[model samples]
Structure formats: structure tokens, C-alpha cells
Target: MGIRSVMLPAAIAATLCAGGVARAEGLTVGFSQIGSESGWRAAETTVTRQEAKKNGDTVKIADAQQKQENQIKAIRSFIAQGVDGIFLAPVVATGWTQVLTEAKDAKIPVILLDRDIDPADKALYLTAVTSDSVHEGQVAGDWLVKAVGSKPCNVVEIEGTVGASVAANRKKGFDDAVAKDPNIKIIRSETGDFTRSQGKQVMESFIKSVGGKNICAVYAHNDDMMIGAIQAMKEAGLKPGQDILTVSVDSVPDMFKAMMAHEANATVELTPDMAGPAFQALNAYKKSGTVPPKWIETKSTLHTSQDSDLQQIYDEKKNLGY
Candidate 1:
């Protein structure tokens, strides 16, 4: 089914209604995305556009291609264009204060999507809509612990981009989880830069250094990296799900496909419908002069083989441009 044909969740539907047609209709918003870095990011962009259309609003998107400077320029452009609000998925956690101050000076309410910046200038933006990255990592790690039991396992980790808040929080959460289990240990850890090619390269080097037989499992920061690791294991003549248990965050459609094929063990979902809640908050703010909470947390659902309708989930997500 197409994205438009898919039914909105009851809560989201209620949120849309709560905004009221009169308050949300014809509102112009600018969205600055951090480029299509992975399937999950692409889904977020797609869902943002879909939500905007559903609410009778127009969204002008600027793809920053994973650069903070580009995002800053986009925000300035949005300010010059006199948009009602701006949605930003920052590429990094710093250097946003001045540009956000400009947006604030222009009287544009800025909403952060998926990522956040330094808190020193938190007042500049209206609110941040994002999932708890630490929680997502904890979910993945907890699943791995349960699946491995008391067996001694050597795990390899494929991390996200260096210095990214998501990467740091995820690493911290997984470390906190595994710290409880002395039998489970991570032997190799390296950055994949959140790209499939880089993930594959890092995994290849890991396989060479540790040898596939010595490695017990692989934990990636995201599904794209996990998918890349799966390919590396296959090429090295290792059964991914059997010989080396696989787990990661971001329950994208491709990860579901891997799970169905028994190439992956588990994944934690980072929902893409951030814009729905953002628009709801924007509408409420515009209608009643009410200020929303500084942070709005989205769900972090976990998916594994036990889920009966993997194919159905895949079908739904595939149409969302994932």
C-alpha cells in the first residue's frame, strides 16, 4: 500500500484532529534533513512529507547532505523566506546556537527532529521530537544478553559516526547493559560512519583481525551497519544468524527481511513519524500560545523473530520509501 493509503495510528489521528483543521491548514514549514544517510533517515523524510500533506500544510525540505554548515545555511534561507516554523535534524550536536538565535530573532518557532544540539541555547527552539537513543541501545543489548544466555561470547561492535550524540548514547546504553553480564564481552569496536560501505569495510577488518570462528556476535549501531556486517559474514563463509548472532537498532524494512531469512536476530525501531507530533505541537502553540515541553519522546519498539507478521511489516515499510 502507498503511504497515503496506510491508516494513521489512533493516537496520531487524534493528534491531527486535536490540532483542528482551521489551525493547521495552509501553514508553511521548512524542514532541514541530514540527508538520506540510511533507510531509516529516508523513511523519516518520507513520513515528514506525508504528515505535512495530511495536515493541509506545505513543507519545503532542504537536504544538508550531512553537513552542519549546509543546515545552517538552510535555516537562514528558511528565515529569509519567512516560514512559519522550521524543523531541523541537526548533523551534529554543536555549532547551532548562532543560527538558532537568528531563527529566534526572526520569530520563527524551530522544532528539532530526531537529533538535538547543545542545551546552552535550548530556549532558541520550541521543542525536540526524537526517540531515546540510549533506550534503543538498551533494548538491543538486553535482547542479545537473553539470547546468548550464560555462554561466553565475544562480540564485535560497528558504531555510528564519530562524535554523534546518537552513537555516544547508544554505546553507553549497550555498555551499561553488557556490564552486568561478565560472560559477554565486546572485543572489537570501530566507527562505521553510519554508511553501508564503511560498515562493510570495518567488518571485513574485524573478521581478519579476530577471525570469524572466534567471534560470537555482532552489534551495530543501526540496521544499515548490521546489514553490511551480514554481507561480510556471508562472504567470509559464516552463517550470520547461526554462527554469529546479529542485532542492531532501527527496525527498517530491510532488517525485517534479514530477520525473515534468519540472517539477523533483533532490532529496535526508531519511528519515522516525528513530524506528526511536531505538527501537533506547532498547531497547539499557534492556536493557544501554549509552549510545549522542551522534549517530546517517540516510541522505541523492538522487533525480533517472534513477531509473526514480518512480511506484513516489511510490506508496510517498503512503501514509505525505506
Candidate 2:
């Protein structure tokens, strides 16, 4: 069978159990989420949970609270429980080999959702479902360059978790774009851990140290941090979008609201609806005992005030439980 048409092994388990005696429609699946740190993350959880129900599958979810050890423990527990399959949105890429190997040895296929691992190894996961993170960063960078024009701007980067795929790729894309323009200087950069609270705290330091007057722009890896940074700027008596331009990824409804309110300048959309396609793939695999592509790339877009599709997309996402 072609890889593109392959399916997850759990879907196969759903069938071939005579009279549904061995495996019921309530096939238990394990999901380890990256915690409810952002709107995008919340939407992902809502959609995945709803999809599992719609497909008559029972999902056991573990919220990692942004801790790698917690996620590993959850995955191991799922393995002990002998779940049909397991899915994890890894907190960071490295240090996952051992746990993944345990899952593999337990005969429970693993799926990577909405994040990626560095030093890619095929043995760790059957497939990964996520967006082109680097592309998102490049889009954000391109927009900033055009908006800033030929002006020499000092930038402060608010990175995500230290080693997450989104953080690494987004920063890489931003750096690549900034490199083309020698006038764009990154005066400060630090990991915000993809949390709103952390974003605010880190931006506080930047504001106190740089005085916000000399800073040209703030680039955040995700919208949550951007919002937090905006709050910090407000507290410092500095206007966010006006005094210092702001750019971020994840076009969540909150970000859109921020853009409409003029707190955020622009955002790149990273939709949170992987459930439908994931379920479809599972169905195909269960019926055919085949595998799907090693990686499935989702669509993304740039959201600016000039775009008419914002309200419609935002409305749709809100309905999807974002």
C-alpha cells in the first residue's frame, strides 16, 4: 500500500475483532497535550477530543503543564494501560528517544501532533501531523521587513520553549529574513516558554532595561506571548502597536481581537483542526492495515487588518471550540 494512503494501526485494531467482542467502538487512545498555555493549544485539545468522540473512540488526555517529565510519565502510564495508540505533542524535541522507544517496545504506535523533534529519527514515531513551522516564521519576517521598509530597526525577539520545533524553526526563519536587512538588529532575545505569563515577565525586563523608546519592534513566536508583552508595554506607559510594532504567529481569535483593537500588528494563522484528518487517516488504516505519509503538512495564512477573511475564519474557529 502507498504511504499516502496508509492508516494508523489502531484503526486496524478497531476491526478484525469478531462480533466486536475483543475491541469495542470505545477503543481507548491516549493523548498527552502541551497544556493549556495558549488559545491555539486549547483549540487543538478541543478539536482532538471532539473528533475522538465523533469517531466513537475513548480518549484519555494528560495535561503536561509544560513539563517534559510529566508528559513522559503520562506516556508511560498510557503504555502500562495498554492503550490502542498514543499521541503526544512533545514539550521539546530532545530527550524523547527513551520514552518513545518504550512505547515502541510496548507495541503501542506513537503519533506526534502539532510539534516536531530535532535530530529526526524514523524509529521514534510513525508519523507527524503539524504545520510547516519554518514557513510561519518566514511569513512573519517577510511582513515585518515590508512594514518596516528600509528603516534601521532594533528588534527584540521573544522565543518560545528552548528547543521546541516551533521555537527553533520560527527563530531560524526570522533570523534568515532579518539577515537580509543589515539594519535590523536584535538587541535582546529570550525564551518565553510559550506562556503568556512568562512573556509578560520577560518583556518587563526588556522594557526596564531598554526603556522601550529605543526598541523598534517585538517579535513573538506565538500570540500568547505577544499579548503578554503588550500588557507589559502598557504597564510601562508605552504604546504597544504604535510606539513599537508587534508581530507574532498563531492567528487565534484572541490575536484577531488584539489586531482589531490595534494591540497587535499582524499574525500568521496556524489552524487547530487536526482531528478530522487524523480520524480519516485512522479509518483508512483500520480498513487496510496500511500506513499514511510520514508527515502531513497543514495549511496556514497571514492575518492582517486588510484581509477580509479574518472574521469568517475567526468565527469558524470559535465554533470549533477555540
Candidate 3:
């Protein structure tokens, strides 16, 4: 991975030490969430809050509830409270400069989780922790290519939110991999906002417009959308995994159930362990005056129908909300 580095001034370093555990309640953190929209997102919030409770750290939790303005308001409030650190799951990559700049001017170290901000001003924030979205997308695309072999395929894509890094990077990775295989063509593509209802609605339209036989597969940015598409296929009197090849990111329980039932082919894993590493970084930076790289890429896994371990994890994790 390429380096995305940020440097803190020595003068600020001295101030950082002054606001140590005694002053900030031993690593008080302010966390801003995008929203509990999908299973993966819910898992992320659940894991983060649980980790904070386990550590007995004072964490101010703010739910943006899928609104960028709400996220901005919560962050500014965290800044006002003089929290030791800040964590932001930005709604949109752009338009974050003002709020991030506010944190910087206040000398508060900021950690980005999940999504990322525009790289035009790298010094405005501390670092980010997120999945390698491009790689995850490529995994899905590659799996589809191998499964279908050289057969001509027509595919429809259900995209996530626009302008988000996950949406952009995942799309780029999938397109790059699919481009290598000339026989596969994307017949239709639309945004589902990473929600089940939206995914189902989009699939309904695709089925009506192109009919079931024309589409060989469905590539959704997340599992929720894929699940929605699967329902639409069933209602249209078409099989999902068998009649139309399906692949997506996020190995939620429903996807596993679909895989077991032979309605969904495969999914790449997105773990809720994101907060553990972020908090570890924050603790290290605070206690020892250590600064991490600007970008910390989280790990992911690809699960096919053959992986028993995936099925186990899926079954266990599904019941627990994120």
C-alpha cells in the first residue's frame, strides 16, 4: 500500500501531552456515525460502542441518522465539549473541509472511520481506518468471471450512495476486473443507497425492462441490495443464484442463508472490528506520543459457497445487531 502520511507540529505535540488522561478522562472519544442504515453499518456501531464500554472509556456517541448536516452538528458539538479525540464517519467525502478544519484549528486529533474525505488537504485530519474497498469489489467481479467462464453475460449493478469512497472504490475495482472479461456486459446499473427496499425496487424495474433471461447476473455494492434483488427475481418467476449469477460485498447473515439456499453465489467480508484498531491507534498516540500513518487499510475476506467457516460466522453474527 502507498503511504498517506500526516505530520503534527512539535509545538502541538507539547500541548497534546498536557491534555493527558487526567484532563480528558483517560482518552475520551467523540464518535460520529453515518447512520444505522444497513446490517454492516449497524454492526460497526454495535462493535464500537461495545468496545468503548469494555474499556470503560467515556465515549460520546452521536448518530447522524443518514444526514450529513447531523454529522456535522454532532462533530462540532464534540469539539465544543473539548473531547480528547474525535471519530467521524463522514456522510459525503466532499463538504467536510469546514468541519474537519474546525477540529484541526481546535488542536483536536481526528480519526476517520469507514468513509474518507477529499485528499486535497491532507493535513486537516489525523488518519483513517477502512476496508480496501477496491480489492473487495475486484474479488466479487473475479468470482463472477470464473463461475461463468467465457459465457456471454448481461449484468445489472445496484450501487451504493454516490460520492462515498466505498461506492466509488468498489465500483472502480469491479469494473476493472470485469473489463478484463469481454464477454461480460453491464446491461443496467442504478443506485440502491445500500438498502434492501431500494435494491428490490431497482431490481423490479430491471426485470420489467430487460426481462429475466437477458440478465445473466446481478452485482450489488452490498448484501442488502443483493437480497432485495433476489426477492424480485423470485417474484418474477426466476431463480436467483441459479438463473442469474449474483455477487456482492458484505457477508451479512442473509447472504449466507441465500448462499446455503443457492440464491446467492458469493460475498466479500466487511468486519465490524474496525473500531478495535482505531481505538488502539488512538490509545497509542495519546499515551506514547506516537503518530500512525494517515491511512490504515482494514482487512477483508472473500467467501464462496464452499467456506464452512463463513457459514458459521454468518450464523453467529446475524442474530447480533452491529
Candidate 4:
């Protein structure tokens, strides 16, 4: 679906137009990022800053270091500084009500990037710009189903942080998709905390526990973890793409590079340009009083070795801090 089709409440839409175009020119926004936990996140941060710069606005960023408390602190600080708007990539889905209410009371429009908070506090934010993570997982699962055909496969999953909404939803989607085929079984699962180092470490343990030969496939919630899993597979004297078919989310540059080398299978893209639509929606809201949808779904395109533009994709994404 197109980004502009997402709809938000008309009540909150009015707040976005208080100062109009003049205020948007030098718009000072505070972005609370979840930290550079993975390449995807780093790219998100890079794109967010770039989007802010493109709009002739200033963005003050606060790195939450994957801590919800840090994010809460940053949001409160942003409110104190009276930033025109706040962009939050919440580390978790809960405990955001009080601080978000504070931002609402201060008349600051808060936009969520890449993830969504609980529906209970949905009214506190202007809108959320994120991909349908469940759809991404389903895409990954669907690809694996087609790749494996009727073959019985033992799959291992490297998940994101335990409590993160993205992790939960992606897992659910994958499970739902694979449920259709009894031959596809997830034998082992663990959280990699969405970092390459953690993914590698967890994968090392998985390799040891599951044994290199019994595994038929591996699924990671993000490409970073899948990349780490690839290294572990290589070290274990197993060819990842050939021996244990790999599928993952987040079409980061390295995934394409892995695909080019025949070391990985497929990845679903989770666009880092979340801020692009966010800024556009904010501008539209301020300029024409448009109420953007509460949820802006980004593209969830799947990429595989068959894709001809691997080099181009890698080159384009390489400089995005991934």
C-alpha cells in the first residue's frame, strides 16, 4: 500500500498545524533511537538524520542503548527542550504512557519509527512509520516453503530481543506460515538480541546443540543475525546456503553480498527510509491539515539470489551505515 493512505485521528491532526509552514521550516525534532544494535538500526538512524536535513530541519538525537528507561529519559528531555516534534523508536512496547502523555500535554507531535507501541497508548503518538513486521516474517516463511517444497526440514530460529514487539510479531507470522506444512519444523529457537555478535554467539551454541548435520534451514528475525549464523555455519564446516538454507528479514547490504557469494538464501526488506514517510506525513499534516493514518506500512519486498541487482543493491545500501 502507498504511504499516504494510512490514516490518523482528525483530533490529533489539528495539533500538527498549530504553527503551520513557518514552524516546519526550521522544525526542531528530537529523535530517540534504540541504539546501533544492528545494521538496520544504524541505517534507520542515518536515514532519519538525512530526512531531517533534507527538510531543512534540525534533529537532536538521543541514543537509548536498547534501554526503555533511557528512551523514557530522552523523551522527557525532548519535551523539556520543547522540540517541535518527537520521533521515538521505542525499545519495547510498554511503559510509554506517562512520558507520551507528557509530550501530548506539551502539544508535541510524536511519531514512532520502525516499531509500534501498545494500542492502549496509541492516541499519545501522532503516527507510527514501520513495516508490517508480521508480513515480513510471513514473506520469509513463504519463501522457505516454496524453496523446500515437500521436503521435511529441521529449522532453527535466531530471534530478536525477547520482549520487543517486532520479535514477537515476526515469530508469530513465521509460525503461522509454517504451520501449514507439518514437514517444516522449528527444532530450536533463541534470542540473539538483534546484534551480530549475539547472533553469532547464540548460533555457535545452536550449532553445538543441534549439530551441524541435522539442521535443514535457519531463520533469523533480521539479516544481522542471519549473517552471524552464516559465520557460525562456515566455522562449523557447513555451507550455509547449500547445507542449511537460510532465510531472514531486513534486506541489509550484507545479505545481498551473502547472496552473491551463494552463502545465504533470501531476505525480506525492512526499509530504513522510515523517516521519509514520517517527514512527508508531518509536512502534509502541517501544510494541508492532512491526518495521516496511524500506521504507515513500508514495503516488505523479498530478495533472493535470483535477483539480478545484488551489486546495485549492495552499493546503494553500503553507505547507509549498514
RMSD of each: 10.1, 8.4, 8.7, 9.3
Single out the weakest 10-residue window by summed lDDT for candidate 2: 12-21
lDDT of 4 by residue, 1-322 (tens): 3444444444345454443433655678889999997777899889888988988988889999999999999998777666778999988888898999999999889999988888475689889998898898999999999999999999999999999878999999999899888899999999999888899998899889979899999999989889998998999899999999999998889899999999998999989999889888877776787888999999899999888989999998999998
Residue-wise lDDT of candidate 2 within 1-322, one digit each (tens)?
6653466554554453332345576666789998997666888999888889888987789999999999999998887677777888888878898889999898777878888776346877777788988888888888889889999999999999997767999999988888788888899999999889999999999998887898999999998889899999999998888889999998778777777777778898787876556566656665676787878777768887666676776676776555
Q: Which stretches of candidate 2 lie above 4 Å from their native place?
A: 1-40, 53-86, 90-109, 116-124, 161-166, 191-193, 201-213, 235-238, 288-290, 312-322
Minimum summed lDDT over a 10-residue window in model 1 is located at 16-25
- Candidates in order have lDDT scores of 0.89, 0.83, 0.85, 0.88
Error of 2 at 270 (Å): 3.8
lDDT ranking, best first: 1, 4, 3, 2
Task: Report the C-alpha lDDT of model 1 over 153-199, residue by residue, as the tens digit.
Answer: 99999999999888999999898898899999999999998878888
Per-model TM values vs. the true structure? 0.80, 0.70, 0.77, 0.78
TM-score of 4: 0.78
Question: Of models 1 and 2, which has the larger lDDT?
Answer: 1
Q: Candidate 1 — which residues are off by over 4 angstroms?
A: 1-26, 37-39, 65-77, 80-82, 92-99, 204-211
Better of 1 and 3 by lDDT: 1
Tens-digit per-residue lDDT, 1-322, candidate 3: 1232223454454465455435535578899998888667888888887777777676778999989999999988777667878988888878888888899898888999987888579988888998888999998899988988989999899999887668888899999999999999998989999889999999999999998899999999999999999999999999998899899998888888889888888898887767877888888888897998999988878887766776687667776583
- Scored against the true structure, residue 262 in model 1 reaches a CA lDDT of 92
